[model samples]
Target: MVKQVRAARTRQALVRAAAEVFAADGYAMASLPSISRRAGVSAGALHFHFASKDFLAREVEDAAADLVQKMAGEARSSSGTVLESLVGTTCRLLVAMAADPVVRAGFRLGSDPSRKNGPGVLAWWRTWVHERVAEAREAGELADDVSPEGAAAAIAAATVGFEVLGGADRDWLCEERAAQFWAFVLPRLAAFPQQAMATVTGAGGVR
Candidate 1:
């Protein structure tokens, strides 16, 4: 039992260390030795846990995807309207990316063109955003001038942009920046901006 626990802990540490290295250095530049050193594990142990860098990268992306799904599920179950739920989720996502290296690396890896993998976490996020935006449109929660596709694209692009910027400066992922984004878009996106803003502010959307 102790050996199993130790093994699990070692795997977790390796994943985290790899995420940090990948988040900082990108996939092409991240190395197995560096990840092992950061994790405080020997190369042999890292190899035992993960066969290759690609496998480790996939593990990080998978872990990050799970977190994103959890966040989306929470937002979907929130008592607020669809628009408010979307806003809340976006705020949570930026905050997560800011604080969690796993999430940060997941997004970074998802968007890295150098990596020959599939769309990864970004595609999952964008799909979720589109679904929610479409739901909001169907429910008359969005402004008449707004199209679901356009709103989804804009929201996805903006959030992904924040993740990218936050990579260099965490201030980009601050709550204030998220609030500013909602403030700028709410007027045009929400059918009743004031009510949505009120719910948002009360629900930790801003401040």
Candidate 2:
């Protein structure tokens, strides 16, 4: 029992360490030795848990994807308009990126040119944004001139930009920064700017 508990702990530590390294150095540049050392585990231990860096990277990406799915699910289930849900989810995501290295690494890994694998977390986020925008359009929540695809694309691009910029400067992910973005975009994107702004304001822009 003790051995099992220790092994689980060791694996968790390795995953966290690898996420930190990948978040800082991209997947190709991140070395196993460095990850093992960061986890305070021997090389043998890391190899026992993950045969190669590819497998470890996949693990991190999967974990990150799961987190995003949960966030999206929460937004869908919440008692809010599609537009309000979209704003709330986006703010929460940026806040997560700022505070959680694992989430940050997941996004970086998805965009890293070094990885041959397709974008994982990023693609999921884009899809979520597109779906939400489409739903908003159907509900008459978006401005008449706003194209669902265009709005989704712009929102995805902006959120990804925040994640990339936040890696170097956390201020980009702060509540004030998120509020500024929502305040500007909501006024332009929503069918009723005042109510949309009220929804975002009530949410308090990221905790």
Candidate 3:
């Protein structure tokens, strides 16, 4: 039992190290040797845990997917309107990306064109946003001038933009920025003033 526990811990450490390295340097620049050094593990141990960099990256992506799904599920289950739910969901996502190395690395790897057969977390997120926007539209939550497709694309783009910009200035992930974004789009996206100007938890989530 102790051996199993130790093994699990080692694996976790390696994953966290990989996340840190990947988040800081991105895919093409990241190396397993560096990841092992950061994890305080030998290269042999890293090889035992992961066969290759691509393999390690995929694991990071999988972990990130789990993290995002949990947050999105929480937002979806919130006793709030669809628009509010979307706002909350985005808040959680931005916060995760900014605060969690694993998540940030996962996304970076997903979007890295150099990595063949990448996990495509960005694509997954786009699909998720697309579905929710469609649901909001069907529920008549959207403004008459808004189309579900357009709304989804615009929102996804903005979120991606934030993640990219946040890489340099973490201020990009501030809740104030998130609030401003939501407030700006709400008027054009939702019909009711209440929904448009709703008090939303912004990037990095509520304090």
Q: Compute each candidate's TM-score over C-alphas.
A: 0.95, 0.95, 0.94
Give me the runs in candidate 1 sitting further than 4 Å from their true place: 202-204
Comparing 1 and 2 on TM-score, the stronger one: 1
What is the Å distance of residue 167 in model 1 from its true position?
A: 1.6
Of models 1 and 2, which has the larger lDDT?
1
The sequence of per-residue lDDT tens digits that candidate 3 reaches over residues 11-98 is: 9999999999998999899998999999999999999989999889888888988899888899889736778778878877887888
Query: What is candidate 2's lDDT per residue for 1-207, written digit by digit as tens?
Result: 999999999998999999999999999899999999999999999999999999999899998898888987886687479987887788778888887778889999999998988898999999999998999999999999998889999999999999889888888986667778888888889999998888655435732
Q: How many clashing pairs per prediction, in order?
A: 0, 0, 0
Name the top lDDT candidate. Answer: 1
Off by over 4 Å in 2: 202-207
- Answer with 2 or 3, whichever has the higher lDDT: 2
Residue clash pairs of candidate 2: none
Q: Which 10-residue window in model 3 sums to the lowest lDDT?
A: 198-207
Error of 3 at 51 (Å): 0.4
Q: Who wins the TM-score comparison?
A: 1
- Global lDDT of model 3: 0.84
Error of 3 at 76 (Å): 1.2
Which residue pairs of candidate 3 clash?
none
Candidate 1 residue lDDT tens string, 1-207:
999999999999999999999999999999999999999999999999899999999999999999999988887787468887887788889999988999999999999888988869999999999998999988899998888899999999999999899877888986678878898888889998887777546433552
